[model samples]
Target: MTRDRVPHILILGGGYVGMYTALGLQKKLRRGQARITVVDPRSYMTYQPFLPEASAGALEPRHVVVPLRRVLRKCDVITGRITSIAHGDKAVTIEPEAGEPYQLEYDILVVALGSIPRTLPIPGLADNGIGFKQVEEAIALRNHVLDRLDIAASTTDEDVRRRALTFVFVGGGFAGAEALGELENMAQYARRYYPQIGAKDMRWVLVDAADRILPEVGDEMGVYTVEELSKRGIEIRLKTFLESCVDGHVVLSKGKPFDADTIVWTAGVKANPVLADSDLPIDDRGRVSCAATMRVAGLDDAWAAGDNAAVPDLTDDDPDALCAPNAQHAVRQAKLLAKNIAATLNGGQPKEYRHKYVGSVASLGLYKGVAHVYGVKVKGFPAWFMHRTYHMSKMPTFNRKARVLVDWTMALLFRREVVTLGRMRMPREEFRRAATPKRSQRDGSN
Candidate 1:
């Protein structure tokens, strides 16, 4: 065996693409051929498909995320942001959590930085709306919804109670639909505990500019999804957009106005903005342009994948078709990307990536789902079962897979916990109260 100087391989993000691609390389490469380094803002990779379950308290939040250092022990992990990339010089500037920025050089570069939630210049979006991408957001949303129920139950003012119970979600894609489905189900289940609040007291409205929802599952399944959700008392406002949301007052394009305490924005995501600072060839959509082999176009020793790269969809016959930004393609692309990288290091030609779209499955809530797989359409319990089975198998590591399965098994045998720890948002409340003895003394006359 010929041993060569270690080639430093730098992965820009610790997302699904970066983490999985590094795992593949660790297994394929020899003893001392290359050194792998991963950089990201977070120390864990979230299994996004299971986020709705986490929010609904069906799965523990800890089980849905994989710790990066524990999983990638062989690689160097840095919790930092890549502020800029100078691909022409094979270097990047990183702004870590605490300290001055520094530059590092590498021989091989993998630009797997993922997408960011796309936002519009709406009136109250920045102050009121929350996103559905991270685990923390999911947990916060769960607590927020339960807290709203508590508020509604305790308050006598009709307007305050109505606003607290109303949830407005802007987007009709899988994220928005799944989030709305799981949360609505959770709220319904929780309503039984509140004697003052009933199912009729709560309202869920899903707004989307697009004419249809769940486009990934086909037109038939999409229509079925709308019908199923409508039967559950969810208002589907298609061909509508949020005109303004100033001061919690939601004004729709159809001239309907209402007040909602909660607003979730899951409309879409665009490629990470950092790509614009690099010298690499970026497409019009602000994504790094790559060939079918996952190699960056017009650049040597450079690779890109996931949502940040605009790789051609060779499986589709259409000349202008690009791969959709979904977990299915991201996971598969990581495997092929690792292979091509290893082949390049071994002085071999890289293979082009091509795969057929098998199908999609989305969970509506516990025991309810919709799936369209390989020309077969299934709904209700069967589809929900398939949803869990597919995502459980796709989870990154064996440890996570076992933990997730245990969570599900426990939910089957025991009742799901519905207690909301709203105090998580105010971690320092007790300390502040204890420190202020004068205020407590003044109010203790009762």
Candidate 2:
């Protein structure tokens, strides 16, 4: 804690809140006042909004993620997973590759290890379902979807073709809806190149437990979204839940059973599992319970925010309300949290964090979208344009913004890329086959 040595601030996770908070701290704090250290499994922070476009081949996967080291030059970044937070000892245990588990002591800790995909006890989900959270998953899903199309077109077996063409998405939120819409659009355009495959032949189903989708937007916009998707032949099963997906057989609570080759699970997210290992008080949903000021309840120096923090919604009149886990609140909370932290460190009273829900926008494939922003409802091309404009404006750096814009511009001037490189997922499979001893070669009897 010596002033000359610089006070250490350890931030767990390099997601939206973690990266932005560290960036804010580095810019605001004096050079020797504190040292900001960020620990995350990945070296980059993904711009998740553009993931659907990236998966659809409209945007390159590399352009969707921002490297942490490149952006956070002022702060020390650690590429490792935090195993445990020993708050009593003022230290955290991290397990990194090629090194023993080491402890890093800190004067202050920021718990921002964002949420993970909330998977249910549903069968086959762990084995077969793909998540749309990270950049690698998005790239894998894109390749897998395109590969399935290739398999369907080349095969004459009806059952194999049916399974290959069937795609099931279990969630109606932005991630599920946007990903399915974009990929379906890509597949539709891609089918033109395959003589055996057609848009009509593909089956796309979106299942949601809630009766409505895109609850961020009002009910009216949500209804409009459902109607529009319905017109596109995307099956919408409202008030239905996925009972199980054992062995590729998907069963719904509504009594339908079908086999689908591709199942993307974007139902929702829960707090990071590491939180449970810490001494921090968590809510019933396993999120760190925090005051509106972004301070952990009853903990003097600890703070939490973003998807993993259950911050009370002061803007709402309802007593039971908590802020929705979205980028809007997360970005705002990060700024306020940083200010509050700085204020506390400087002996000033921290301010409360309060903000009203602005609005919501969703992209539905290329040149199509739906939005309800500031009481105005927009759909189709205009909404799509607004969606792009809004996310581009909010995207972290100018370099990333420019790169994304360039990707979109290139998409406008050329046809979408539909090439599938499925072997990338398991490149050794081909090598394994090549290395196998064949019967003709083993006996030299051919």
Give the distance in Å from residue 153's predicted Cα in candidate 2 to where it truly belongs: 0.8
- Native-to-model Cα distance after best TM-score fit, residue 196 in candidate 2, in Å: 0.5
Judge candidate 2 at residue 138 and give its lDDT. Answer: 91
C-alpha lDDT of all candidate models, in order: 0.92, 0.90
lDDT of 2 by residue, 88-130 (tens): 7899999986589899999888999989999898878998899
Which candidate comes out best when scored by lDDT? 1
For candidate 1, give the lDDT of residue 73. 83
Q: Which of the numbered candidates is closest to the native, going by highest TM-score?
A: 1
Poorest 10 consecutive residues of model 1 by lDDT?
A: 437-446
Deviation in Å, model 1, residue 284 alpha carbon:
1.3
Q: Model 2: how far is 345 from its true place, Å?
A: 2.5
Clashes of 1: 0
